[model samples]
Target: MSIPLLKYSLSTQNQRVDGYEVSPGEEQPRAYNTDNLPSSVEMDEVIWAAYRQIFSEHQILSSTSDSNLESQLRFNQIRIKDFIRGLVLSESFRKLNYDVNNNYRFVEICVQRILGRDVYNEREKLAWSVVIASKGLESFINMLLDSDEYEENFGDSIVPYQRRRIIAQRSKGEMPFNLKTPRYGADFKEKFGMPQFIWQGPVRQFRPQEQRPKAGDPALFLGMVNDLATV
Candidate 1:
C-alpha cells in the first residue's frame, strides 16, 4: 500500500503574493512557451530553455538532449509540462540526480527545480520523502507536476523558473537554485573517494619570471651555501 503524503507548513522566507515584479535595472526571467514560439529556430530556443530550467544546463549539446522527447515537443505531440516530465524521468536525470542523492536531498532538489521554490523546512523534506519511499520516483514527480502550485505558476505550455526571486526590501534576492544546491551530495563524492584539499602551509609571495633569481645568481649560490652550512 502507498503511504499518504505527510503534512508540512510553508514558511514565509521566500513567499510572495506576486511573481511578476522586476526591479528597474534587474533583468527578468525569459519565459519560453510552445504557444508563443512560431518557427523552428524559436522552437529550438524553447528546447534550450527547457533544458536550462530543468537540467541546469548552460550550453546543452545536440547529443545530450533527449532526441525522442525533443521530437515529441517539436511536433506538438506533448505539452511543455509533459516535456519536463520526460526530462525528469529520463535516465540522465536518474544518473545525475536521483542515483546520487538520498530521498530527503532528492526531494529538496525536485521542490526547487520542478516546483520553483525551496522546500519550506525539514518537515517538508520529510513529508515528500515519505512519498518517494512509498510511492516511488515517477509517482512523486507526477504529484509535483500536477500540484496546484505548479499549474498556477507554469501550467502546460510554459517552462518552470525560479519564482519570487526579488524580495520587496532586500538588497539581493534569493540565490539561484542551481548555485545553492550542488549537483551531487557530499556523500556521493565520499563514496567515489574524491580528493579533499586543505592548505596547511604558510602563505608565500610569488614573483614574476623576470624578477626571479637566475640559474647562477649570487643570491642562489648564497642560499645554497646557507643550506649547506645549516646541514
Candidate 2:
C-alpha cells in the first residue's frame, strides 16, 4: 500500500492559500456593509442592482423592467429580503429554477441564494430539506427567508449576500464555505457504491499538514522524533 506522504490544498479558480486570488480555503468576510449603501442617482438603478445581486444566476433581473423594479421597491418601501423572497418563490423561479433540481439540490440552492452562505452541514441541509419534503416548497422557502439566522446576518435593512465566515476549530480552522459543503452530490451517491437518498459527504479527514498537534498530544513529540530520525 502506498503511504500518502503529501497532501495538497487543491486550490483552484479564485481560491488560494497565500495569494491575492479570492479562492475557497480562505474565510472571506463581507466585502461591504449595508450601513452606508451607495447613493444612486436613479431609484430604479438601485432597486435593479439589489434584484440582480439576490438572483444573480437567472436572467430574470434584467428581464424585469426598470419601471416595475423601481415601482415595486418603492411600493414595498425597500423591505429587501421580503422583496427577494417574492421573486424567488414566484412561478418564474419555480419553473425555471426549482423544477429540475431534486429536494437536496433545491434546498442547498435556496439556502445559498437566501441565506448567503452554505448550509452549516448536511444536518442543516436535511433540516430544511425535510421541511420541503413534508410541509412543501412554499413552507421550506419561507422558513429560510424568515429564519433567525437570516435576521441576525442580513437584518431587514439589507439585501442578502454571502455571510462572512470565522475560523471553525472543529473544522481545523477551515472556512465555513468549505466546511459547509455537502458530503456527497448526486454523482457521488450513484457512482460510488452508496445507496440513494443518503448523502455521504462528510467533513474531510484532515491530513497532517492541514492540522496541528496540541500541546499534550503524544503525536506532536512523535512527529518531531520522526523528523529527527529522517535527519
Candidate 3:
C-alpha cells in the first residue's frame, strides 16, 4: 500500500541537497525513490524540455535594440538557478504536505523557468530566456539525468521481505511481467503477456515498477505515463 505520506523529510549525510550531510539544525535531505513516487528521471525530462524551448527560442545576444541582452541573460540564469535552489535548498518544499508540495513546486519552477516575466529588467529577462533556450540550462537540466536501482526503489517494496499478500494487492496494476525501457512495455498485452501503458494521457493509470522510456521517444510509452507536454 502507498504510505499516507502526509509530509516528506529530506535528510542527507551532507549539507548539500544534491547528496550531502551537514550539522544539526542545518537540513537533512531524505533520499527519494522513483518507483511509487515522482522520479528524478521524470523531473529531468521535464526540465530538459522546458530548457530546450526557452534557450533555443530566446537568447541574450540575439536582440539588436536598446535592451541589454547580456544582463537579461545573467538574470535569467539566476532565476533558473534560484528556482532550482528553492526545491533543493528549502527546509520543506511546501507548508501542507511535503510530497504534494514538492511535486507541485517542481512543476511550477520548470514552467516559470521556461517562460520568463515581462517586467523583468531587460538583461534579467533575456538572460533567463537564453539559458533555458540553450546550454545554460544544461547543468540544471541534467540534475536528475541518471539514477541507479537504489535511487529507483523509493524505500518501499521488499524483495526478500516476502509480503505475498501485499504483492498480490499491488500486482493488480503491475504490467504482469518484467520489461526494459523503450520497447519493453510494447509486448505487455500479447495474449497472456503483460499490458503496456505508453507515456500518453493520465499518468495515474500507470502503476509502480513501470519503466520510463527514453525521453527521446516518450510517445512510445505514453500509455504508461500521461502529460506529454511535461516530457
Candidate 4:
C-alpha cells in the first residue's frame, strides 16, 4: 500500500509576510512567462531561462539539454509546467540529481528548485521523503508542481524562480539554491573519490642558499696554478 504524505509545520522563515523591497543597486529577478513570448527569439530565451532555473546555473550543457522537451515547448504542445516536469523526469536529470543524491537530499533539492525555497525543516524533508518512498519520484514531483504554493507563484505559464530573494532588513538575501546545494552530494563525492583538499601538506617556506666561496676553500685555484707551472 502507498503511504500518504505526512503533515509538517510551515516555518515563518519561508513565509512571505513582508512586502518585497529592492535596494538601489540590487538587480531584480526577471520573470519569464509564456504569456508575453511573441517571437522565436523570445521563445528561445524563455526555454533557456527554464533550463537555467531547473538545472541550476552551469549544470545545463548542450549535451544535457532536452531537445524533445524543447521541441514540444516550441510547438506549443506543452505548457511551461509540463516542460519543467519533463526536465525533472528526464534521464539527464535522473543521472545528475537523483542517482547521485539520496531520497532525503533529493527531496531537499527538488523543494528548492521547484518550490523556489528551502524545505521548512527536517520534518518537512522527512514528510516528502515518505512520498518519494511510497509513490516514487514522479508522484513526489507532481505533488510539488500541483501544490497551491507553486500555482500562486509560477502558475503554468511562468518559469519558477527564487521567491522573495531580497528582504528589506537583511544586507544580503539568502544564497542562491544552486550554490547552497551542490549538484553532487557528499556521498557521491566520497564514492567517486573526489579529493576535498587539493593540497594536504603544510606549505614549505623558501630559503636562499649561500653562493659565495669561503677563504678556506681557496686552495682550488693553487692546484690549477701548480698544473700550469708544471706544464
Displacement of the residue 22 alpha carbon in candidate 2, Å: 17
Q: Candidate 2: global Cα-lDDT?
A: 0.57
Residue pairs with backbone overlap in model 2: 14-22, 14-23, 15-23, 183-201, 184-201
Model 1: per-residue lDDT, tens digit, 43-137?
Answer: 88888878877777532445458989989988889999999999888877777778777887888888888987778899999988988888889
Superposed on all Cα atoms, the candidates' RMSDs to the truth, in angstroms, are: 6.2, 16.0, 23.8, 10.7
Instruction: After the best TM-score superposition of candidate 1, give how far the Cα of residue 151 lies from its true spot, in angstroms.
Output: 0.6
| Candidate 4 error regions (>4 Å) | 22-26, 168-174, 187-231
Per-residue lDDT for 173-222 in model 4, tens only?
56776556546777778879888967879999765556545577775488
List TM-score per model, in order: 0.76, 0.52, 0.15, 0.76
lDDT of 3 at 175: 22
Clashing pairs in 1: none
lDDT of 1: 0.79
What is candidate 4's TM-score against the reference?
0.76
Model 2, span 1-231: residue lDDT tens: 422212223222222123343565644443322345445554445555455554553444444434544556665555666677677767656764566556777777677667766545566666666677677788777777777868876777576655544432333454333233333456545666676565669867667964877779898688789999999
Scored by lDDT, model 3 comes in at 0.30
For each candidate in the order shown, give its overall lDDT on alpha carbons: 0.79, 0.57, 0.30, 0.80
- Report the error of model 1 at residue 77, Å: 0.9
Pick the lDDT winner: 4
Reference-based lDDT, residue 122, model 3: 34
| TM-score of model 3 (CA atoms) | 0.15
